[model samples]
Target: MLKLVVNNDLHVNKKDTITCKNSCDLFDEITGECSINQGVDIDSPYEAARCGFFIHRDSMSVPEIKDHTHFKFSLMDDIDDDLLDDQEIFHQLVGKSIYKEEYTYPLKPDFSSYRDDAKWFVSPCGSYGCWIVNHYKKPLSIPKSKDVAERGWNNRVYKSPIPLHDHQSALPISSKMAWLIDEDGFGQYALLVNGKISSISAPKPINWKRH
Candidate 1:
């Protein structure tokens, strides 16, 4: 429903990969290597947008690092199975896994609405779900396949599962969703105190030590 611009402002593209060139400085967010030696077409800007926006939590509550919870975030179908029946390119939770070895928090706090502000969301496969926000910010990583040892950022699991309210859209939040805006306007991560995001950066790196 949200129209996010995939501003690859740098116009960054490796041999065949469109990567997060901007964020790599924070860490190598882009792949150092590619599956094919030749270049791959960047997901169409429209497709990219539908494939969803790279959700960056501009604000959130503190997480209870000590607690470990089982979140059903990986299964796109269970989240909206009817939509996934065609199985275009959406992820399937049936064979996927959740990341816990590092204790990531993708499942909690789908949004950081202080009271009701919501962020525009698209499933990695492009499904849109109802707005949500919990009291705190917990980074839970959703993984494909239940292999505990394989739970890490790499290995095609970095994309968090998108939650659709209904109707199956596996590669983009269909335009249909935006038209159904509920009373709340559903989402807007930009908190307007005077109309701007709070602009706070992570104070420090946290090691949850979650077993």
Candidate 2:
């Protein structure tokens, strides 16, 4: 059965749970009045993704590296926890990434054929950037322990270089499943299938060992 390949130590079994916030929750759909860079101070899923949250360069499918017209770069924070009624301005100020397609790294792995369901592998962890690799013998430090918790931001950075051994044949699971990795301290990664834990079909640990 195709499954999400996560760290072996993550406590995500029948007893576990998960919650996925809507992409809009990160930043609402911007109309003519509000910009996409709005920020909410009361602790929201969108805070970390301010400024360029509206436009996306990376996608669950093959990336569109050249479609960067607005740039979507972060500028400054505009607090929205106070402006409950104001819709004219965004919670933050931002611009686009100055670099173009050439500067950006390869979104796909250097391989031959890609899988028909490559997008499905990224569906669960699309919100937070996820990189699939061929090998990781060293135990995952971030989300695994506090010693390297401070370096959690490096998840996308560190794994980025190690491209997936098989770009197309990623382990697939139903979109009904939602995943969350608590890197700050909980030291747990969860998967909620069909909005609840009861939906998991014989939850089991994934094989992340290098082939």
Query: Could you say which candidate leads in lDDT?
Result: 1
- CA lDDT, every prediction? 0.25, 0.24
State the lDDT of candidate 1 residue by residue for 1-211, as single tens digits.
9998786667656433433222111111233311111132233333222222222122122111221122111211224546446342121112111122332122232222223434444445432332333222434344453343222222221122322223221211121121111121211111111111221111112442212
Cα deviation in Å at residue 29, candidate 1? 1.8
lDDT of 2 by residue, 42-158 (tens): 123344344222232222111122221211212223434554243211211111112222311133322211223122233222322122212233444333323334322323212
- Give Cα distance to truth, residue 55, candidate 2, Å: 2.8
The clash number for model 2 is 10
Question: What is the number of residue pairs that collide in model 1?
Answer: 20
Task: Give the poorly placed runs of model 2, Cα more than 4 Å off.
Answer: 1-50, 56-146, 149-211
**What is candidate 2's CA lDDT for residue 117?**
16
lDDT of model number 1: 0.25
User: Cα RMSD for candidate 1?
Assistant: 20.6
